[model samples]
Target: MRTQVAIIGSGPSGLLLGQLLTNAGIENIVLDRVDRNYILGRIRAGVLEQGTVGLLDEAKAGKRMHAEGIVHEGTSLAFNGTHHRIDLKELTGGKTVTIYGQTEVTHDLMDRRSETGGATIYNAKNVQPHGYEGDRPYITYEMEGIEHRIDCDFIVGCDGYHGPSRASVPENAIKTYEKIYPFGWLGVLADVPPVSDELIYANHERGFALCSMRSHTRSRYYIQCPSSDKAEEWSDDGFWDELRRRLPKEQAESLITGASIEKSIAPLRSFVAEPMRFGRLFLAGDAAHIVPPTGAKGLNLAASDVHYLFEGLREFYGEGSSAGIDDYSRRALARVWKAVRFSWSMTMLLHRFPENGEFGQKIQEAELDYLVHSRAASAALAENYVGLPF
Candidate 1:
């Protein structure tokens, strides 16, 4: 098979990119190692930066999102037994974030692709990109016990951190930076009303906890735990009790407890791979970088990466220009690094570091105090939270 672009992975990045390319009259096919159901089963972060929402609109997948997604003008930060609100819209000139599940985004993209009759091959095993260093690169994969090859002009690796896309790059050609936090987030999805109208991020002596919601009745909550902790070890009552202890008394009192629909522990980490472009093969989303979920930058960063790659490809195909494609890595990395910094800073400011001792805790307290008291600090937090410029 021959196409203009061969995309790997069927996650939001790959689907979004495929949709954009198809809309531009660019022929592309997506290949994923897993089936459609498996892809949508994974739960992920849901906060949407305005830039991400615009991209979804461009992809023609925004109908349900705009209808169901909750708009948050601001977020509350709870520390020292007080809840402080940061006005994201006011601080960022009318900018706000949308609370929509990532699963829903994937479903919408899948529906759009199916309606448009786009090509997406699932259960494609052992997928590999070859000859990307020179022109005429192609992808190879195994399906139903048969090997197949796809000749394409370019290859996009949205296959994520462990996927073949990044593994295809020569080890020496890439530089990696990573930091694993000492703690992980024990998250729960429950069918109960959220405690607050807006998301609440609490920094307490116990740990860090966040109160987020997918809708008015579907709530998602997380509390920091040791990296060694497991979700099964905590019962629903225990999780709720611990979570309440981490928040202010008033916010905790208003909280409603229920049986959890989903529960898991996710380790926190910050990682980035340099030079997202490897000849004709380019990496986007988790394939190139990962940020701690503190500032909710994971999906937003992926959207920005997709935006940069799409622009480059669009310019190349539409204007017969290679400038955008050639500059993709530099531009994407510039924004990626900023998000990495912001997520890292937020993680440091909110989470209690057991190893950091009393001195570190005091420093965190001072930082949070200054952040709520100083307009400049508050605005900076709001800007990063709503998302930095695309």
Candidate 2:
């Protein structure tokens, strides 16, 4: 198939790019290694930044989001058994993050794209980007073991952490930077009501816990855990007991009432690659960088990348100029790096590390204390949390 842009993966970045290009009257095809049923099959981030809300709104992806997404006033931070509320709207000039699950976002995008006159191929296998710098560089994939090809002007890689996009970039074409943490987040989704009024980030000597909601009936949260254990080994009772230990004792909060437990182990890591573009292929989203989810910047950063990249492509095509295209890599990296730092900071600060020296723990506590008491320090957290306006 021939297209102006060929997008890999159906995650937020790929879909958004397809939508944006479609709106711009640029033809594009989105290829994925999995079907729609498999694409929306996992549990993921639910929180959307205030700026994310605006961007989706402008792109018309916000109507369903605003209607279905749970809007929170702000989030809470707990330490020493006391909670400090950060009024997000007050701090960020009335910006609010939404508690809409990523699954919902994908479903909404899929429904819209179905009527959008765009290509969404699934179960695509053996996908390869070859013959760059040509009028018809293409991606090869197989569905049901039948090889197929997608011819295009450029290929956009939005594949997640473990996809083929990263490997496709030739050696020395990109510089890989990464930091892996000592701990990982154990996340869960329950049908029970949320334990608090807003999302709460707790700093416990035992570990860290996040109290967030998916809807009126579904609550989501996370706990810091050792990186070795798998969720399958954690029984239902074990999950609840772990929750009780992390949560404050005063509240009789328990996960029950037909709440099916789904757990995921999240490794805290920060990574970035120099020059997201390689010839006719451009890497965006996890194919480009990954931040720990503590800052809730993962999905938003991916969306931001596609936004800038889409604009650059449009400018290039319209003006027959390569300036915007040339600058796409640098411009995308600036916002992505900021988000990486934010995620890394949030992850390191809130979660306890066994390997942390006594002095390091003390230093961490001191910083947390300053964050709660100092307005300047708190505002910095608030801005990064609520997200920077792009």
Q: Which 10 successive residues of model 2 have the least lDDT summed?
A: 250-259
Which ranges in model 2 have alpha carbons more than 4 Å from their true place? Answer: 133-136, 251-258
Which 10-residue span in candidate 1 carries the lowest summed lDDT? 381-390
Clashing pairs in 2: none
List of clashing residue pairs for candidate 1: none
List model 2 lDDT by residue over 1-390, tens digit each: 678898889987788888878877889999898889887888888788876676566556767898888888778887766778888888877778888888888887777778877788988888888877555688889888788888888898898778887788777777999998877888787788877768888877888888778888788878888889787777766766776776666532543434456778887889898788887788888998988888999888888887778888898788787777778889889988888888888888888877786766677778889998888888888888888766
* lDDT for 55 (candidate 1): 98
lDDT of 1 by residue, 1-390 (tens): 999999999999999999999999999999999999998999887999999999999999999999999999999999989999999999999999999999999999999999998999999989999999999899999988899999999999998999998998999999999999999999999999999999999998899999999999999999999999989999999999999999999988989999999999999999999999999999999999999999999999999999999999999999999999999999999999999999999999999998888889889999999999999999999988898887
* TM-score between candidate 2 and the true structure: 0.95
Estimated TM-score for each candidate = 0.99, 0.95
Query: In terms of TM-score, which candidate is strongest?
Result: 1
> What local distance difference test score does each model get?
0.95, 0.81
